[model samples]
Target chain A: MTTTTTTRAAAGSGSGSGKSARGVAPSGKPFVTFEQANRRLKWALLAPALGFVGLMIAFPLAFTINLSLTDAFGAVNAGSSYVGLQNFADALTDTRRFWPAVGRTVAFTLGAVVLETVLGLALAMLMRKAFRGMEIVRTILMVPLLATPVAIGILWMLILDPTNGIANHLLGFVGVPPQEFLGSVSQSLPTLMLIDVWQWTPMMTVLLLAGLTTLPEEPEEAARVDGANAWQRFVHIILPMLRTTILTALVLRGVDALKTFDLIYATKGPGGGSDFEAETLNVYAYGLTFDYQEYGLASAVLVLFTLFIVAVVVVLRRRTERSAS
Target chain B: MTQAIRPRRVLELSRRSFGVLAAASVLAACSRGPQTASPDAPLRVLAINHVWTQAISRYLPELEERIGRRVTMRMLTADQLTSSFNVKLNASATDIDVMTIRPLQDQMLFARNGWIADLTDRVEGDADYRWTDFQDAPRERSVTAGAAVSVPVVTERPALYYRKDLLEDFGGAPATLDDMLDIALELQRRSEGFFGFVGRGQRSGAVTQWSSFLYSFGGDFTVDGRSGIGSPEAIAAYQYYGRLLHDAGPPGATNMSLEQAMPIFAQGKAAMYVDADAIYSNFLDDSISTVTDTVGFAPFPAGQAGSVPHNIPSWSLAVNEFSLLRDDSWEFVRWASSPEMVARLQSEGIPGARQSVWDDPATLASFPADLAEAMRVNAANGVGHDRPEVMQVGRARDIVGRPLVSGIVGEDVASVAADADAEFNDFLVRDNRQQEF
Candidate 1:
């Protein structure tokens, strides 16, 4: 490959005028043509990035796919053999934990993303106009985003404590009964979603605010001149213009919420409490991997989970494109 | 041509240098041998962050001198240690020379996977080791599948902790489960902000404490490799436990683990709490406990049969099977498990597994007398393996514990036990099949 490239360079140079001033040879041949050098530089810059993706993403994905077809359970060196789709069959057929986990994962992701997007847009619109103390509000909003997820979970645990938490104390003043927020299986998942919204809504708000700032103001001005109300202007003009940005927020938040592990693990622990009520696919797969050493089953769950996320993203992207057109 | 030649020469030089650097590094790594340090080097130890393991930190210098090597220790919490050790040991990591093990919880799993080295022969050969000096319950529990995989380091038996002042006003200590419940209810009715009873109510974790009740009711988790959770005695035990915790336990008892329950009892909010005797110090520590002076210890109250508490070694020290410095690792284990080390641990107010240490005058003087006596009586009548002694004990516990939780949450006891029995039987069959190969 090197010899062919060198020969091509020499041949091309022979047909050209005396070597160009930059990167010229004394023998009247260019050391390297701009085109060739540009191509080489492109590859050189991309090689490390491509290698990184291959090592970190592609390799693990491929290995997980391979493992999903085997009976690799227990310790890493416990000696496993190929079972060929048994794990996939087992996971797909499992209604007790697997199906419920998939449902919770979907509920958690969709619930968190939709709520975050709505709340974030409201905040973004509120902050779109410059005002005094705007910076302080923005900084306070970023606090939740900056805090670690596990730390946030712990903080929420304290705040939601049934007996001594400030939440119950405030509720008491209003004649409201104290709720078993994290302790009750019925309430745990929704409580976790609320926490997700708290931590990530600011992120969505920031992203949308940037998009809002960049939006062309002409359309909204025209809508206002036509006597459209504030709600009408927002719905028809500003929102349509921010289709791609809305989808971007959803895609980002949705993907993260689907893989919500640390928050749940930090608070509820493995198997997502007694009845496995809060056990999403990520938590279930994690328990299978670390708790039970069911590597093959976990790999299968991960493969399916990746596929589900991809499908969701593809559908959302198509909708975004349709709205754009 | 000269310009092109100059660039090529520089490229070639750079490539050759890079190759040389890579090769030299590879050679250096190869020469370093296994990740384990040399026998004369510092031994690496991994332990869970507990009072017992923390006590060992103070004696590191003494242990180093005795073993003729330097010592280093890394302490992690129980959850952290389990996950870290699982990943490390599974990958045949040699970085850890010695590690702590929960003999009843982890022995069979670790032994089956060949993660821990067998210490039977070495332990027997050491003259000063006096392996027989260790309590029988802890000693026997250390052996998994006939191999002495670990040496007992911290032994604990479940004991009843109650408010002495409250029990004294109610005449005396409750001798039976019925009497205990009656007293708990009376105290709770008389006092505001005081719960009658508190224990681990979380599934999986609750099973460990619940086993004492199950055994007292003449039931066990498994008998002859089959689940006994559906037996009449087991049902009665589950129902009784559920009634007590539901009627008298703190609100949201279903969520409380040992960490949550201990605090309630220590804060004088709960009249009685049953858990590992090792945590008695937490209640006795004036800084952490509000009722340190009023706390009293007793054996678990009798049920249908007799009061039977769990007498299991909570922590053990074992050499990693993958350690290249096996002898050195064993030396560390030996020194850590020595009677002298046990005595030191006892003096530090951490319980020890060695009978010699427990019987020592110094140990007796330093530890709480009532709690120590309760521990001895509990151990004498204790049942081994608080959770089931099975492969995938976590899974098994989850199966049986679900019913316990459901019953506590107002489900019918008989139906929940039946369902749990079916699931457990299925698990046994599936597990047995997996073991066939």
Candidate 2:
């Protein structure tokens, strides 16, 4: 694309005289090359996007960072004084809520993303070839993704109710004991992770399927002709080629899983149940800001959360790049 | 050359765009100028989606006519209402003329930020409004730092909900906690899927309901302005509640909030439930409840300290401090919380904070005979606040609720209460310090 644009620019410039190239501007400034004019045009075109970024992301982030340093509690416009790193120190030193939230956030993301990737890849492979009812199956898979998270949470709550829920009834049929899904303090986080997997695995499958369609059929066919088994062919040929797509899916799903609020909040509510069992960092920070009105501390927690997310993305991107190379 | 002409064209295009942008910005700025109350502007009310709000909304046309303006009422869930208030009020929004606020939960924070208008003169000076006619407990909750910042609209107290059919063999609803427990255990022993007791066991959500338990056991949330949750009375209260739930309640009782636990009783799966009296309609509603005919209501059972239930103004009406139509806002609050309106609404099965309404037999005629009797008795013996009174009520509830959950999960209540007491003391100090501003 760049080469084609450069060639067109070169031809246009060649058609002009050398005098025209060195001509004075209307403002009597020195003449510029085609490349210099192109750069200026590029910047002009990019200005809106850059401005949007500044307004939407940069400004709020900078404001949050600034607010993190102050004792901005109560109303947003209320008087506040500089508190330096006291808020950050308080969050870091806190072991009860903040640290548990951090641990849950990491565990939720890692567990949900890894499960989604493996299950998604397997589903993608299963549906790779044309089937009798492929479209219907694919359409059905999209239902969970299309429905709102809060609705899904509520539906799951009913389905998992200890006494009245169908889940326990099904377990009874299998002679298994009734399990407290969302109701149990120890099971809420894992149950939510499983729900996350259920909702997002299809998303990963669709992405992986798209990548699968783009891969050349030559490698798989060659492996089949060389006496490779199905698992051998998948491991040796298909998996390596699907590495980039897998990493991309992981990053997308992982970030979303980490920042999950609606599902957990809708299901477990504020402080994430009686034991703070399912409270993630997002839920924690939200309780701080809206529930407790601890704006300074919430801002500090948010800053740390943002850094953590960015670091995760950077590490995953590096892995993807290395794998591709 | 083409390139030179293109550069000039680009510059002209950019200049035109900038000019258009500048014009649009100026127009936008003009449109957002000072929001003075225009005659055509609606008297905006932000409220929770409660029965009281729904009932009041049917009579909004009368309010609008009386105030000489259109009225716009927006209703949201409890959490959504809180979020909207925090975000909009923090920005000094003038659109919200009247807001439904929780006196025990949000009045302090709202008062601290000066987000709610002081209605001392409006409520007190106006004899027709009859501020003193409100029940003393709920009426006192309307004041913050000596100024009446809100007017009580909806009053709630805990009620002991029992399955009348199931209690036939047990003679009736138990009058004491021990009797209730014994009955609950006996009832549980007779059934396979039925639970004896179900109530809110959620950490923060359970505190309000648990307040009655703590009080009946001869403890307050605070003693001498310090944490009282570590007191022996408090721990014993916690242990008794825990044992009642753990032994006779359904599996996963700790996760049961009002929304979860209420349904168990409504569905006839639980024999007894103790929760806010405001939700009694859920038990009566045929669509949601299976045991509507057999559901029975009684006052909170007695404990070591006798019957002490929390009679709180669960929902109240407050005018926004930043409202452009302050007079209209006050008029709305005054009109909605008027003795006539309270009596009228109370007759419609929505409990109001008026003493005259509670005393009137005609108003009591709407509710079930036993339920009305139970409500009156609870209110007469009720405490003002259900949860801790603080600027950060949610955090305080969390700190105070930890031991409750610990006890529910069959852990050591005394140990957890001690740890929670220390943490709560620290929180109280920080909260008090923060409240200075």
Candidate 3:
């Protein structure tokens, strides 16, 4: 919505300015042509934003790429000589940490986003028709999203504690054995995914609900009159209309899940615990950069991670466009 | 669309812009004066938020009066402090005049990078400072490449925390690792919810605590600058630790660090726990612990080579290399780590590295009798370091800790130790090569 609105507003203003420049006369003859004036004004308005982008984003990215090609270890200001693609070659061949981190990053994002989409669609359907206490329900749903990620991690640590947590206590009533959620090496990633799903499914529901409300009721009503059941109508008419929203939500949540660091860091700490079971790419890069101070190798890993994210985003966006067409 | 101005007009405009820029520069210069440290500027000290920092904060006014300048101490967690130093020191920031540091962990890296100021003259040239008064182990750790880069402030060694009530029938805390294991296992078999033992099981966090076990088994992280973990003694130590935790520790022990494991012992759910003696106050604090009355402290139990814990300067004071107020920074360090101040602080339950302070019985009055005795014995027999001494200590710890995690999870420790040893040997070679940079 933001993207579409911004583009339309800019286009409208641009055409309006062009038309007025040629059509209207202010005072007398103009010193400069319309194109010249428009060009100057556009540059005047864009210089500050351009400067900000260059300072804040482009400079650091360029610096990181440069550093990736050098042996920039220990101190940032320390002297370093170019080492070509040695850092990249080393990171790629590292079967111990780098590859496992990449695998975990993909697994986490895929599992969390898929589960969130399915559950979010269902919840959005349930909350489609406004009912009593709907405002309270929506507000309650926002609680998990409102809390800080570190606080959420610590809260879950307490809740999922193997010995004294209420989760284990509740499980005991149903004769289920106590389970280690974030504690076990094999279960840590899956446990964190459940937490992610809990926190972000509400955001997915809210986005999909907005998309659902904008849909025309005619197709669903026609399907119902043609003897189509609720399930059939949902699978046929509603889902097809909601496709764009689903994909948009997926891209948003998928990007976030891929770069998750705070919760993992807060819960499992550096190297993502004993066995590196929960070490995603973000965590691995962070440990290298900050913990070990291997800036060159870390920069290489970050460069690769950025490319991976870009590739994922491009693919998801192309899929979204295809569905929309 | 580009328009050209006359040459004379362009020259005039350029002169006017230059005049304006110069005026603005003058005004900015006048606003803050020069970019050097002034006499009245606060002596900024970046420190960890530990009991020593808290205790010293209360007496900061004294230091300010002594230095005749305001003192500002910013406290953060250990990790946060390290991160702050890395960024600020990398940029050669001068705001941090003094900082608390972990000598064993950061001094080598800091000294190699020239991020910490050399203090050999200040420590040795001034005879009244009594630099040699610090204990041998901690004092040696203060120097890197024959230069004193930091001063040991707080010293630590592991303590055996056990339930006096639980071990009463067993006569007391176990004197050997084998006896402790048996008692812990028997206790576990006797109860359902109670764990027999609890300690750090997280890979990196557990390394320092596990160092005692390694040394007690007559093993070291390295032997003659090569990997030592694959040796029989080291492998046996690994297997023993793995079995101890796997058989008697709580389920999901691999996830427990000091923070997580400490609570189990504090809550009276575990029979025995081992961790830094510096944190003994936590168990005694009624607000956070339930077994304060029944808690007993003992030296690290004997192993194949008898009891040998790690004696380390867990926290120290150092001057930033880029600090403008070098003399003032030295003065602050001199005052904070002096024999008089060490005795005063140690008397208040904060441990110090001064041997004279440790020798005095009055300073130990604040600590529990058994705990004080345990700390003394451990200090006497302790090794100098708890982890491998290297520039990239974090990476080294990660490699050394893998086998420890395998042991805790009941995996085959021998195979894991061999793999980790090979990896560590390769890492050491690369690490030495990187040191040339």
lDDT by residue (tens digit), candidate 1, A196-279: 999999999999999999999888999899999999999999998898999877888888888899999888877998889789
After aligning candidate 1 to the native by TM-score, how far in Å is the CA of B334 from where it should be?
0.7
lDDT digits (tens) for residues A1-325 of candidate 3? 6545533454556566765433322444323333444455465468668757976999999999999999887877787889999999999999989999999999999999999899988988989999999999999988999998899999999999886678988988898887878889889999999999999999998999999999999999999999999999999999999899889998999999999999999899999988899999999998998889999999999999999999999999999999999
lDDT tens per residue, model 1, B64-134: 77778888899998888888888899878888889998887777778878899999999888889999999
Using lDDT as the measure, what is the rank order of every candidate, best first? 2, 3, 1
Name the better of 1 and 2 by lDDT: 2
lDDT of 3 at B281: 96
TM-score of chain B of each: 0.92, 0.94, 0.93
Ranking by DockQ: 2, 1, 3
TM-score computed on alpha carbons, candidate 3 = 0.92
Name the TM-score of candidate 1: 0.91
Task: Return the DockQ of model 2.
Answer: 0.50
The global C-alpha lDDT for each of the candidates, from Candidate 1 onward, is 0.83, 0.89, 0.89
**Runs off by more than 4 Å, candidate 3:** A1-41, B1-33, B189-191
Q: In candidate 3, what are the lDDT values of residues B161-209, reduced to their tens digit?
A: 9999999999999999999999998998422568889988989989999
**Which pairs clash in model 3?**
none
Report the number of backbone clashes for model 1.
0
Q: Can you tell me the DockQ of model 3?
A: 0.36
Count clashing pairs, candidate 3.
0
